[model samples]
Target: MKKGLIRTMLSAVLGLACAFAFAGEVQVAVAANFTAPVQAIAADFEKDTGNKVVASYGATGQFYAQIKNGAPFEVFLAADDTTPAKLETEGMTVPGSRFTYATGALALWSAKDGYVDANGDVLKKNGFTHLAIANPKAAPYGLAATQALDKLGLTQAVSSKIVEGQNISQAQQFVATGNAELGFVALSQIYRNGKITSGSAWIVPASLHEPIKQDAVILQKGKDNPVAKQFTDYLKGPKAAAVIKSFGYQL
Candidate 1:
């Protein structure tokens, strides 16, 4: 009996050692719009796989620049499909590692109630003193917002009143903090539980702008990293898909 007990304890120790040997960390660069969902997904992934994810959130364009300069991210979740595809072409990422993870929706939002109408006529009414948006050059949401404005013929009219944020999160902050009357932001930032939590918002129609197809790719540095590949696969699984949908993004 003593011999059997000793063997059992040795097996347990070996199992624990194996688990530790396989565990690893994946460094992720996530787009600001995906922050909440990605964090939740990462937590779920760690719980299930015993691996760790260290994520940094920022504008996709900025992440692109950093990746070009050899940032040590294993995976990149971009806010648009174009950037990832561009990286793949430039040899910064594993060829064919790119895939659309989510299609984001944009909303014109205000921190105050009754400011925005259901049809988004607020843009035409020109009742607000300042309008906030992410920098079109840096953020996909900003580019979408610009496209929507141009489609509505409000680009020139609202040009002087525009306030630019560094990213979508900051643009939402501009409205939330009263820095601007209203701004275009990612729907995920202002939505939860199938409803808008605060203020008024107009969900921009998909027809107004090009689809914001958010994509993910394994960077060249992570080509052989098992944890990185697993994280990317986890993102396409049901658990991660559900979490992403909860954040107002369409998969």
Candidate 2:
């Protein structure tokens, strides 16, 4: 029995070796809010399929412009489903290769512990001088933040103190670096395993904003690339789903 098990293990190693021998890279355009989970998923994907991922992270609208202009990205992971649908309508993606990968949530976060209350009452208190947000024109999270403020009847009060970032990552940076006392950010940026990872945050109620259904698609540039399709398939698998959930994204 020991010898039989040894042979099985050796054969598995050889099979993985063969898979790696033909490994190639796929370029992916990823929305900034997905950075952490995607990094974890990509590592698992490479281990499982022997394909290298070259990922570029940025705003969905920015990625949209790049993809439309013939960027080398083979796959797109957008912050909102509409952007992927837009690309499909524009003939920039492979037909029937798009699907929603994750649902995102927003949070009002402060780098200082205990600054943001559990119910997010600080926004109405108007105690903070600066509030960072992603650019609403380019980021879905920013639009959600705006919508939440509108719902709370604080849009006019918050607008004057708003500081905008080109992407969600930069918006988080503003709070982390103390450029802003507190700001709206992707919940995935600071949450893990059903809890906030650092500082303080209030996960915004979903009713305040439209659903953030993030989508993934194989771009037209990857129509002939097997790895691009493989990556997209892997993203929908249980392993990737676990990572996404760990980062506060809903699958």
How many residue pairs clash in all the candidates, one count each? 0, 0
Regions of model 2 farther than 4 Å from truth? 1-16
Q: Among these predicted structures, which one has the highest lDDT?
A: 2
lDDT of 1 by residue, 190-224 (tens): 89879998999999999999999999999999998
Structure candidate 1, residue pairs in collision: none
Candidate 1: RMSD over Cα atoms? 2.2
Q: What is the C-alpha RMSD of each candidate to the true structure, in Å?
A: 2.2, 2.2
lDDT of 2 at 118: 95
Tens-digit lDDT track of model 2 for 1-251: 99999999999999988888999989999999999999999999988888999999999999999988889999999999999999999888999999999999999999999999999999999989999999998999999999999999999998899999999999999999999999999999999899998899999999999999999999999999999999999999999999999998888
Per-candidate TM vs. native?
0.93, 0.94
Error of 1 at 231 (Å): 0.2
Estimate the TM-score for candidate 1: 0.93
